[model samples]
Target chain A: MSPKVSQEHMEQRRAEILKAAEKVFIEYGYERATMKHIMDAANVSRGGLYQYFSNKEAMFETILEEGLSLELDETLEMLKENATSYWDMLMKTIFGEGGEPDDEMDPLAPAKLEFFIIGRNDEHRRAYGKTRYNNGLSIYAHIIEDGQRSGEFSKKFDHEIIARSIIAFIDGLAVEDAMLSREDLRIKEQSVLFVEYLKMALGISEHSTDGK
Target chain B: MSPKVSQEHMEQRRAEILKAAEKVFIEYGYERATMKHIMDAANVSRGGLYQYFSNKEAMFETILEEGLSLELDETLEMLKENATSYWDMLMKTIFGEGGEPDDEMDPLAPAKLEFFIIGRNDEHRRAYGKTRYNNGLSIYAHIIEDGQRSGEFSKKFDHEIIARSIIAFIDGLAVEDAMLSREDLRIKEQSVLFVEYLKMALGISEHSTDGK
Candidate 1:
């Protein structure tokens, strides 16, 4: 009889493969990066990789879904704690800690943009992209809604509108970051400047002393 | 003897080919798009097409350069006239007049993004992308600096920083716009909302009461 692979072992193997797939995707991008590359990078057989993900789209969806869910869970936990101020929490959620808005491009930045832009023409990919974008927007809008209810944020602008703006600003910066030099893009500095714009738009009375 | 084509006729034919190339690029995107597609769309022989442009890159560069120059000249003329409010002129320059922010995706949006993101991996393309980005940034930055100097806009934030943020926001919105439905993205309304954010950041005192 063949040895039964435990569920935990399968999960571990899946995670390991995903880590490798991420690397492959980042290096070669969506269109050019093939399953052969993933197999080589992950050190998995064709049968093994196929068992986990039928194709590149499935693999990419799983990767993005996993990353987003993890992020959402963390943000949700932060919301429940309610220890941090709304603005601080929002900034942390968006930019993360110890992020200095420097010139270092997210290694996966090119892949991420390539995936969506190329996906534009594909119906299946477009549907997945839309669902993912809406999911992200909801998380952000919820934070703003919470702030407004607590009177920490101004009621001047719609929470959903403000939330979408955040997405736009970040995405726009990423587009520029992908194309321009760090010196020219000045992402970190631009992000700092964007935070100030956020403060004004959200009608936050005072600026946080942190994030500098 | 072969008939001589005048320089004007040659220039006109080149322009015609570019227009068709734009359509082909929009349909197939940058990577998948082929010179044959452009030739078929333009109804020119491959030889004829090659006479004007050595490759897809040269064709794309010519198209983009023409667009930018036309836009820059119009904007410079606006600055000279100085009739419009700085904010209005900036918005017009960035979004264009009569742009309704509807669901009609910029047909070129995907190709434009694909070109730059893929360019991230190619050194020659990367260098060209950076130069193009800086040129665009300077146009916007110049508008803001002019505003600050003229006392038409407040200097609350660095003009360059503000300019970069505008690029970031627009690019970010385009990223989302390319992926999501117009209704889901809320681009038109969000753009109007973002103008409010811009006002707050720039310290523009009164709302324009336009673009409603």
Candidate 2:
């Protein structure tokens, strides 16, 4: 029989399971990673696993939320606390150049993409696109508008357009990282090089952020 | 009963079906736009549809090929047509934003993105990204390496990194266009805005290609 752990112990167990789950997902890709593997990795019984989470997706969702939340909080906090212009800190975050690297990614992205691509059928991709388009964009749009109103940025180009472009840029970066490519793109210098290109692209300097 | 038509007429009918398929995919989103819907819009028998294409995915692939082949061909042609600075025209062709407008876009982009994102999980997204990355970027990398050799752009940065970033930037633009709140983003002005931002990022003369 599975051990009858207390509630506190169960919560700790769930965290441990999720921690293992993240490693499996990263190594195997979401579709290929099996429940048996997760169970073995987590060192939990079948019934025990069910008690803590409903399914693989629920487990992933929790990990995704907690992981991305931590990463986003750290990235945004770095940007906000630095008191540098949005452009500089944004590029730095992308490069993982400065401050502590809180997991060099937003965890929800690959899973969100895999959901659109792998899960469901034809009816799903379109619906997912609509939702992805809506939810993925609004927060950034609000952020851009705030930057503009506060005079931290300019209103020369369409704020929505800039926001969407930046969203796409970040998305593309995540895709780069997700690839099982022949080239070793994960090294620190390579990553920083890419981020510097983005910095120049956004005109992130005190010289150019003057509404240039 | 199916109506008989000349070979030329049948070919024209096939073209019409693919065109309608594009609209159908975009209109209903990729997943929900069924073969039945596409048949109704394209005025093709289900048998005829199957004859031209095996499934919704096949039809989507054909539509993408029809739309984007010209742009890709043009990029390759421009690369070899002259001994001019390949990097300069490279920006113009992909991101610099000069093209004969069709419907509401530069024709190649909106549909390319639509089909790619629709097939984000299919062999198509992988194929599309691979073909574009391998062929287009392999060519651009050559030019950047040449520039590095000639000591124009910085030799301090990896030519491969810059080439990939530029490709990612262009891909990111297409993805942004593919997924955006329509109210916030206007398709007509997208190419122009993209070019402007690209020029700023690259720190090039505002009118480099104007006299050419």
Candidate 3:
């Protein structure tokens, strides 16, 4: 193969392996998952897996980075477009296209929780987690700040604190999802209530769609 | 010794062992902590530690139950007395005696997170977690319900959902605390913001002290 074609093929193979690794991590959780399992699932030889990733932690980190980076990019793009109202923008950022909560949760949530919680004491993992958290925080803070600046939201509360609370609520739900049954989580109800909170804190009426 | 005295001695020893186990769990975290560590910390014989609790899970459960039950009882007693306003009672229940957020966090918080996250799939542990969650939920819900009934809080939102959000915020902070430095967690700031949310959702003014 030409050098250019070879480069493209290598990238495709790496993506394929990551897809398979994600399934194994989700199924068995981070602590229990093994690279051998990823190799089998990806239909790659042991050497092939090792050539792409050194360890499970490296694989998991890459998966998390890719997913979060995609989300961050999408949110930044939405903000630049300014096609949606601030409230709707915030909702879409949190709950995806419909901007509503349902019974569904990220399937990889438990594995992600395990990865961070289990490795919390490790300096490298903790540093990475902090960076990921700040990145997530910035997305929400940007929405709130824009809303405040545009007179769409009140300046009654610190935009960053409000943003941080949003992260807390979502992270808290992830923790609850791990421990409780889906029915018991009341994810939809809590989310609806949280929206009410954001509206009240932002001093925006529920009916307001000024920027829509 | 008399039979009654012997029984008291046994109870005292059990409490001492739990105290030592709590220390061990806090120092090493749940996944790494062992019965042997507890025995060494408590300065007890293998048989002595085993006599009161069958395993590490049982000991940890007892520690959690004891702490929560005590908090629950205190909250219930405060409610019966009607010695404080609804807002103060709620704040006190969440933040303890001063009804304000501070830098301190429960020493056992990380260990508790580890226990539940690691054993999330275990039938027995999951059941215990659900029960514990409900118990914690009732405390906040009760405060909100009483406030609404007494005309101190707004009936605009369901008290149960408000209560659940409070738990989510607190649990989310705990998760953040594990992965980030204390400064990064911004525990006090996030907590103060949450209090603002509770105020808005309940429709109570910051100055209100109707029952105080």
> How much is B18 displaced in model 1, in angstroms?
1.1
Model 2 Cα lDDT, one tens digit per residue, B1-212: 34655767878888888888878776665655699999999888899888888998778767656656866676667656643654465554554234322114233444444344434355646666556556666666777677667644446666676666656655555454444444444544544555564344344454554544
Stretches of candidate 2 exceeding 4 Å from the true structure: A1-5, A20-61, A73-92, A97-108, A116-166, A176-212, B1-6, B28-37, B73-88, B95-128, B138-160, B183-203, B207-212
Q: Is the docking of candidate 1 incorrect, acceptable, medium or high quality?
A: medium
lDDT of 3 by residue, A40-85 (tens): 9999999999999999999999999899888778766765675477
CAPRI quality of model 2 = incorrect
TM-score of chain A by itself in each prediction:
0.87, 0.70, 0.92
Compose the digit string of candidate 3's lDDT tens values, residues B73-192: 886776567546888889888887778888788888888988897788889998899999998898789889999999999999999999989889888888888888897777898888
Q: Provide the TM-score for each candidate, comma-separated.
A: 0.89, 0.62, 0.92
Ranked by TM-score, top first: 3, 1, 2
Error of 2 at B174 (Å): 3.7
Residue A122 of model 1: what lDDT? 88
State what share of the real interface contacts each candidate retains: 0.97, 0.22, 0.84
Instruction: Please identify model 3 stretches exceeding 4 Å from their true place.
Output: A1-6, A210-212, B1-5, B80-82, B210-212
DockQ of each: 0.77, 0.20, 0.79
Clashing pairs in 2: A122-B31
